[model samples]
Target: MQVIINGEVHDLEGQILLSELLERLDLKPGRIAIERNLEIVPKANWASTTISDGDRIEIVHFVGGG
Candidate 1:
């Protein structure tokens, strides 16, 4: 399947869940925010959010530096 991630296109395997994608990107669920197809996916739904073809995902990582 094909999905647009952070403005880039990627070819992924079958039924890729949002949590799985976060793992692949080396992201920690508690430290980042994920928006799928214009909707914010709650933390509880990360594991259940399945990404499909043509879905647009925006992943933002939070960093602390001051």
Candidate 2:
């Protein structure tokens, strides 16, 4: 499957949930925000949200810096 994430296109395999995608990418659950298909997906719903082909995902991670 192909999806757009943060303005880039990514090709992924099989049906995958948001949480699983994050885990596969090694992203910390508490450190990021996600928007799917122009809608904000709550952190709690990430586990239940399924990512499909052509879906647009925006992942914003918090960073501490000056």
Best model number under TM-score: 2
Residues 1-66, candidate 2: write the lDDT tens digits.
999999999999999999999998888887678999999999999989999999999999767878
lDDT of each: 0.89, 0.92
Candidate 1 collision pairs: none
lDDT of 1 by residue, 23-50 (tens): 9878877767789999999889999989
**Which regions of candidate 2 fall more than 4 Å away from where they truly are?**
63-66
How accurate locally is residue 41 in candidate 2, as Cα lDDT from 0 to 100? Answer: 97
lDDT of 1: 0.89
Per-model RMSD to reference:
1.9, 1.6
